[model samples]
Target: MDYMVIPDFVERKGSLYLRSDHMNYSRATLNSNWHQAREAEPKNYDINVFPKPPGRNLHTATYERIGHLKSKGLPNTTTKSALEQISLKPDFTERETRKSMVDVASFGHAIIDRELDAPSRGFGAVLPRHHPDYDKLHLETTHKADFTPPYPYDPAPERPPDFPDNSKAHRRYQSQFTDTADYRRSGRNTWQDESGVYGNTEDKRTVFPRTNPIPERLVQGLK
Candidate 1:
């Protein structure tokens, strides 16, 4: 009989001992020196693998806590430590006391008095005929009154004797040819009539058939 030997078990002095195949068995041993050496070395950590926790922001937190004190009617102690409080009393005695000391003849008053005495004239105001500036103004006005706009180079081109000059007459003349169907039919008939003159009867023959009921002359002699 053959007995199978277990790879993980070893027979030492008739006692079976389990063998350890761990790669770091030496470091994992129960030795005081290995433990002390590992403890003495500083541990290094990667920020990408082991991220740090986000701590509280003191600036934003402080601003939010004291934000309401910056508005109106609230006590702002940054600029001034002691602030003057306003009185709600409505006494008019001080205004009346200083009324007499105010100057009545100021620069503005002088200007108003001067204008009232002799007012200034605007551009639209008419000048007297005897004034020295009236002659130049009269000359400029006369020149403007005599001014005339220039005419174009081809203002009136020569027209044919049969062409109508008046708008109504021109429209009436154009109305004779305005019927496009009649114009096209007449043009086609004229071409057929004069086809013999050009010695090209193909167009006429193609347009009018030999079995047409109309006379040959009326059908443009297609046959």
Candidate 2:
């Protein structure tokens, strides 16, 4: 089966081997050219052959070591000063303690007063004062006189030239109802009827009586 394998199948199977051979050939060609160039120039391998030492030693002191060495010979004045300044126990002597308490109270009071007096940092505070619209905002915030009519002196349409007095006009209008016979017959004078039934009048000015009156029951209740 290997001998009878198709040529295309064999070529496809050996594609990786062919690619590796081509890469090796290219590498070998470049190496040969490099060797020839080196031989032509003939560089001396003995002269400073190893890489030059770094400008500074690789084992040079690190920051931690440098700081430790620098401070080793110096007296720790900073720590001593801090220790001296700090109070291990508060003094309860009456005058000193009272002064300290007063100072603390004053400090808190000063903070509160400063906060209260500080200018507000709200939107109104940041609004531009010089803007053209600022005047309109100021006007809106301020109180002004109530609006007067545009034509205050215009004599109110000359009063129709024949307008009647208000009392006379009202009486004339009321006469339409007061002068009618139906209005007179509607019993507008009293709230109760002659039979003592409340709100049973023709005009219905009050609530209607819910129960019919019994003469016998009324007489018995009265007795």
Candidate 3:
């Protein structure tokens, strides 16, 4: 894995990153994404698969990790310990292993050499993002500001039709209060106003005063 990236590679594991907007690096979160292929992969080719195209080989460490996972729930396993053992002889490297597991998925799948996809949220994933019984802050809001109120209170642009991100945009949307002067003086010097996840911007950084749209009476009602 170490041989695939830039500068002081193996020694600098924490230095590399997959920027949120940067596709050059990948943030590999769990086994499902790349692990599916590595966990139950076929044999490594014995010959020189050389000058191989990108996404052409299985990453050794990833394969080893997933391989360990595949052995779960077997009969002889110990109840005392959950650790799965993998042999780490000093002699296993891409050069030493002699064969390489080829990545047929075009993502190369090399343990250390390529960027792998992180696990995606699955079928029941939406559950974590919302509360079934509790009304979402913005959805089901009958407050007048909750809708497209009026001037100086116009709605922010819809993120997009499907938006493709969290419904934060749709729900967080409320009638704007105050005038353009208030917006300007509110210190909205930067676009990066973070409520939670996305405030961390690598572009330019600054702050601004933010005003909530919900009328005080409505907020008390919801509470």
Top TM-score hit: 2
- Across 39-139, the per-residue lDDT of candidate 3 in tens digits comes to 44553341223345564554433222333455552344474344433344434545654444555574455465333353234454422443464674655
* Candidate 2 residue lDDT tens string, 155-188: 6566676864344222222223334444443555
lDDT sort, best first? 2, 3, 1
TM-score of each: 0.12, 0.13, 0.11
Q: List the residue pairs that clash in candidate 3.
A: 1-112, 55-107, 55-108, 56-108, 59-110, 59-111
Runs off by more than 4 Å, candidate 2: 1-129, 138-171, 176-223
Write candidate 1's Cα lDDT for 114-183 as tens digits: 4333324444434323445655644456566677456536457778899733443222221223443454
Candidate 3: list runs displaced more than 4 Å: 1-118, 123-147, 153-223
State in Å the error of residue 216, model 2. 76
Which of 2 and 3 is the better model by TM-score? 2
Ranking of all candidate structures by their TM-score, best first: 2, 1, 3
Q: Count the backbone clashes (under 3 Å) in each candidate.
A: 0, 0, 6
Clashes of 2: 0
Tell me which of candidates 1 and 2 scores higher on lDDT. Answer: 2
